[model samples]
Target: MPVPSISTKKLIPSIAGKLALAGGSLVFGSWVLSDIVHLPGGGAGLLALGAGVWWVTRPSKPASFSEPSSLPGWIRRCEAVLAQFSELELSLGLDGLRSSREQELDRLKALHEPLSVGVVVSEGGTHPTTSELQIALEGVHSLELCIAKPLPVVADAWSWPQELEELDVILYGLPMPLRAADLLRLEQLPTDRPAWLLIRDSVHQSREARQEALSCQLPKQWCDRLLFWSGESADLRQGLLPVRSHFVQPSRSREITKQRLLTSLHRRWQAELEQLRRERFRSLLQRSQWIVAGVVIASPVPSVDLLAVAVVNGLMVKDMAQIWGCSWSSEVLQVVARQLGTAALGQGVVEWSGQALLGMAKLDGGTWLAAGLIQGLSAAYLTRVVGASMADWMALNAGVAEPDLEDLKRQAPLLVAKAAERERLDLPGFADQAKEWLKSQRYAGA
Candidate 1:
């Protein structure tokens, strides 16, 4: 007779089936050993051996082909037990996540509105020529504009229309450079709304003449918003119309002028948005520096202080990266930490801080408390320097540059010095502000 061959596919399951039968037999044997066996120890030993064999040969379930109704009750029970551990009940699906993100984006978009613009023309001065006025009006489709003359009120007292007060931007239309008196009158108006000085004739003037006109015609404070608006090309227009009454059906030239103006205004608005973002980032950096300084002061060990500084600076860089729309990761943090560390070492900031603390100790009766305060101030100043340097680096790269140690090292000292000077001037106010901020944070946490 030929030897029978076992199929490999069926062999394991056959063995497993035998093992399961043996396990049941062992369980029954255990009962028999206790209840009936005359030689109990021998029966118990056999039971244990059977159990071991069953454990070693235990089988996995085969792929299910039966209908749900045919599934074993025990197998269904096992599935129920596994389902309890699954995250399907707790977590959202991909569609849910995408919807949440879109809602957040819509909320942010709702915070923005069209820029409000007001056009100011002095009563005594010449009005903007028809061409100049047209150019100024074309691109301002998004702004709400109103023509206002200097209110004939008391010197240093001018009332803006309620509408103008609500406006976000102002365009001052000047026929010629203002007299000194008019400049002073301009200064008395609210500084809250940003104003632009649109000089009608200065576009064709020499650079020196324009500067002289700005100096003589505008207040020193308003020089920042001054611009030459010679209506030579139809390209230089700004602000929005106050009423639809000012609107007219456009000729081809007028339409072209409107297009150019709109383009220019859009570019300006984008630039303003970028500037506002930078300012907000800088403010956050300043606050972070102050908080880190507080942490350093509270830390007992100098090494811990250093570590905190590095960590905080790294976080600040990460925030700046986000503001600039750059990806932040561990590698970015490491780059920032390395750059800050190198700058600190190169500038002898640590030694300077130590010396400064010692000096402050002498002045403040040499107490530990005084020393801690001084050290904190020093740390705060150094953090500001690091933040300022990082800000400059980000600005230079426009937030897209690869991490470079050499660039950071080179830029740090100059920014550090500037930051130090700023800190010196603003220390008292900053300290007060920081204290208030800390108290608010503590309250919030509580």
Candidate 2:
């Protein structure tokens, strides 16, 4: 039988940390207010306490996954698969998928191609690898797994991948595991399995190892089938899909809730925002972009980079930029060069560049990079742009009037700054020429 997994549970600490920080901030604020007027008990103790709480709950790792021992064997099997690798690589397969799963499947699909990579597990029993195959097909990935009659799942930890042919699992109440240890021991096991072992985890090896053990026990028939492509050949591509139990998204409710929450939150935040310094805001956005871009390039964590940039830059996380750029009008200008002549992303994407500067002057400061270059950007691109163009597009898409772009001008300092800044991007342009063009534009802005 196939195994089951769970949603990543290690990330809980991050949420707790945020809550702790908020609680600390409240206490710190009260302490500050009291101290100002020489309250009888005002002191730094409360501030320290608050800081401690923030320190504790701030998310340090992904959520933890703790399984109940009494849960069904299938569920336990799933957890073992996921704990094998980073959540990004382990795909939660079918036989356990819920409704409206396509949205999630697509997101995973967008991240990586499957045919180019494969995971094959030829269990020695009658387990329907096909069922698992269907689940994985959602992402256009394939795996090679061996299967046979059913059997009891053991908690054994010593079952190495090479000797799993002796495992106790029976696909259909069969007599014993179709042992493949001989093939493995002789080193005669075809080199092309491209498969990961799905088994129980102990102190040393993971559940993937267990699965590997099971594979080693396969019957000659199935074993021989794999032997054809077992040789190390470039044409036979295989990869491991560490299985896991994770919830897919693009959920309508999640979308609505996130949108509404951000809208209200940003709106309430604007009161304080009105007093916020432009340069300070610019610095924050720049820092945010660097961090996010760094993550996008450096890690497979997710799309948090673009979203994080939006949050720090005071832009609406979900709203169309053309409609919401007004909210950020004072700090940035966003231009979105769509892939198609229209917004439809059919063929692929082209390129886009954004420049940030001050009145007719190109500005550069510590860690403040004001320009960005984007190549082959996708729908994900629209996500990072901010300013008038964003607001225009959002408003246009939302069926609202294009807010006044009337009387806007290239402020000489900002224009000059933006122009000179252009040279800093990954493009072929001289700073002087870009500067001259920006300076000459009439300062007719919304």
The weakest ten consecutive residues by lDDT in model 2 span: 339-348
Model 1, stretches more than 4 Å misplaced?
1-121, 125-309, 328-333, 344-377, 399-409, 433-446
Per-model C-alpha lDDT, please?
A: 0.52, 0.31
Identify the runs in model 2 with alpha carbons over 4 angstroms from their true place. Answer: 1-320, 323-423, 430-446
TM-score of 1: 0.40
Q: Give per-residue CA lDDT, model 1, range 1-446, as digits (tens).
A: 11111123421357778779877877787777767775567566986776788688655332222223221332343233223213222321212423343343333223334444556665665445555565556554454445565544345545455546444556666555346545655766755345666665645557566766567655567766656545554435432233222333323223333333333333343354346445656677777766775677677455534654575555677777655545556576567656665565566665665564454433334233555555665666667656655655554444343554444544455655554555557655655555555455446658
Model 2 per-residue lDDT tens digits across residues 1-446:
01112223442258878789877877777767586665655546566765798698654432222323322332333333222222212222223222223332233223321122122233342322455434543443242233432322342332334333221111121113334332342243223222323221223545355445545766443432221112222211221122211112223322332333233223333322222222233333334434444434334332333343343234432222322233433333322322111221221111223222322235223222323312111112322233212322332222122322221221122322232233235233222433432233213211
lDDT of 2 at 278: 28
Candidate 1 lDDT (Cα, 0 to 1) = 0.52
- Which candidate tops TM-score? 1
